[model samples]
Target: MKASSGYAGVPRWVLAIAIIGALFVVLPLVAMVVRVNWGQLIPLITSKESTDALLLSLRTSGAATLLCIIVGVPMALVLARTRFPGQRIVRSLVLLPLVLPPVVGGIALLYTFGRQGLLKAPMDFLGIQIAFSTTAVILAQTFVALPFLVLSLEGALRTVGTRYEAIGATLGAGPTTVLRRITLPLVLPALVSGAVLSFARALGEFGATLTFAGSLQGVTRTLPLEIYLQRESDPDAAVALALVLVAVAILVVGLAHQASLGNAGGRQRLL
Candidate 1:
């Protein structure tokens, strides 16, 4: 295809960088596929422990994702739309977990919420024990995954703008009504993308989940934790579980890409 006069302004390096970036992203999956032993993959995937870890991964990751949406969305709204003292620091802090080592995050969680830690008195008073429990797994996942939701949603909120919500207010729509009828639909793609990213991260989370939640079968042992344990004793099962995680990560990226394309299409149609 010949470039239009306007399109001729695009630089060749931009295209080269994009191609390189795509290959970088895809190389791991290509390697995984090439390394997979198909004959034993199904058996490993179907084993009782594998199935339990997978089910636990799905359940805990799903719960953590829902918690992320419920909590992170409102925080994103505030961070994107509100101005206040310490706002810069708060925004940075909100994203701090993204930069923090997952192991450190788990240690931090333990220091704050572990049975003998800082909040132990109050937590115990409430009859809630955090460490070594399924709830602890969810909390650890949420801690590590929440920032993805907040950052993505905050970016989307910035793009969507508050103008529509203001218009809704001018039209006498209540805050809840305005959010549900105007803002949310506009930011839905971002929310979905963020949620999926959080879920993917949660599914693959290891260090933090292992440290804070502990590896207990049918309880806190997520797929990543199980895979790590299996890698030492059962290489085939480890590869099989790793493949499952890879498949899920691919699915999440695919869905995010499709949503973005759909959003672009909608914009083009509107234009």
Candidate 2:
């Protein structure tokens, strides 16, 4: 941390760029907030269509976040704690969605889960239909949100390291015991931060969901999808939904920030 009083000799250009970057993120939110029609804000958001969209968004995003926690934790563990041939390639594949366009992801999902997909015969045999349904929304959100969890958990695991687990093992504790008692608790903050990020990402998912889930109201139309639909006919509703999304983003960022601060404080204490 730097002194509160001054820049501590930071270069002007670097500071200017950093300020610009911050403004780029913050300005859009300010613009949306400024344009909100306060008179109809509550009614607009609480309208039947808006409520349905909000509820669907929350449920699907929540489910997606849970899925990320379930899968991402173990995947991060494998990446951080084990090594094998093609490990880098595997990690890169798992994180491909971070860089891949949402439309591309949607297309990939459509091919993989659609009626005539590669595994269609097996899925049909098992009676599992995933594409263009509520399940598809969760899957798409998970695809986009998974990287946040995996990267966050992997960094946490790296920071906590294996020393504690090693000591616990020497003390006759089992692997699961050590993980449950020591490793997980140590990384809980990062896990939480990651979950917040994942949920936020899922909540704001639009492109993949639109491409894969097709924006059926109350079935697959999430907040972002609803906002898009409202944009052309009801601009106020679109702005209202955008503001709601901005609020959710702020909440997620605040929670993640707090978790990061806790993580930093814990590390400082250890130091």
Candidate 3:
């Protein structure tokens, strides 16, 4: 006759393992926070180099997020709404950056845009250079962050399905009309979540930007790169910057989660 606590049914071993997993992820963050030189935290993170890197990271990551949305949304729609030969392979390739090492992705970008790369002749003819520039930093971030948007939006599209789309067609709505009015509105929350996640990923990009763009303060030296450089000469500054990065990441992740919850709520209303 006793009232049950929902979690009481979970096995003790499972609960213990889950607690351990949470601690494993959390303890390092706690340790870093403990290591911070609190008295110098503001000064360390407010230095010229730190501010420059932080600004450049924000700029490039913003550009990268925009680029991801411009391209990733269409890619998601194609993957979710259509069937074609080699579709699985294409999706796999599109999502490759999610699993590939950042350094490897940077290498691939280098060979595609470097002076001696495949398009070298055309680039030289056009008097354009992409390597080791702010553009390169943006491209590197986009390369790695694109998959997050694509994957998120695609899953949402699949879950929402094509029933409403078909009905729109029967009601004399054209494809573009149906898409702009019905499909996009239904998936707006997912799109926001994906875009925020892409921004976070781009903000944290390091290995790819370093390998392709080369760190130059106020240019290609993003916060992550700045943190790495500071780690060699000023551990306090490095830790401070790392904490800043972690805070921004946490904020972005919270936004994504809220957007996801909104999407779930919207679906329930639809039901």
Q: Best by lDDT, which number?
A: 3
lDDT of 2 by residue, 1-271 (tens): 9554426677777788999999998898888888999999999999999999999999999999999999999999999999999999999999999999998999999999988887799999999998889999999999999999999999989987899889999999998999899889888889999999999999999889988889888999999999999999999999998998888888898999999889878767766
- Candidates' C-alpha lDDT: 0.89, 0.93, 0.97
Residue clash pairs of candidate 3 = none
lDDT rank, highest first? 3, 2, 1
Q: Which pairs clash (backbone N, Cα, C closer than 3 Å) in model 1? A: none
Every model's TM-score: 0.90, 0.95, 0.97
Q: Once superposed on the true structure, which residue ranges of model 1 sit more than 4 Å away at CA?
A: 1-25, 265-271
For candidate 1, write residues 1-271 as lDDT tens digits. 9664432576777777887999998897788777778999999998989999999999999999999999999999999988999999999999999999999999999999998889989998999898889999999999999999999889878876788889999999999999899888887877888888899889889889988999999999989988999999998788888999887888988887776666556545534
Which runs in model 2 stand beyond 4 Å of their true positions? 1-6
What is the TM-score of candidate 2? 0.95
Tell me each candidate's RMSD, in Å, in order.
2.8, 2.5, 1.5
In candidate 2, which residue pairs get closer than 3 Å at backbone N, Cα or C atoms, i.e. clash? none
lDDT of 3 by residue, 1-271 (tens): 8664446877677888999999999999999999999999999999999999999999999999999999999999999999999999999999999999999999999999999888999999999999999999999999999999999999999989899999999999999999999999999999999999999999999989999999999879999999999999999999999999999999999999999999999888887
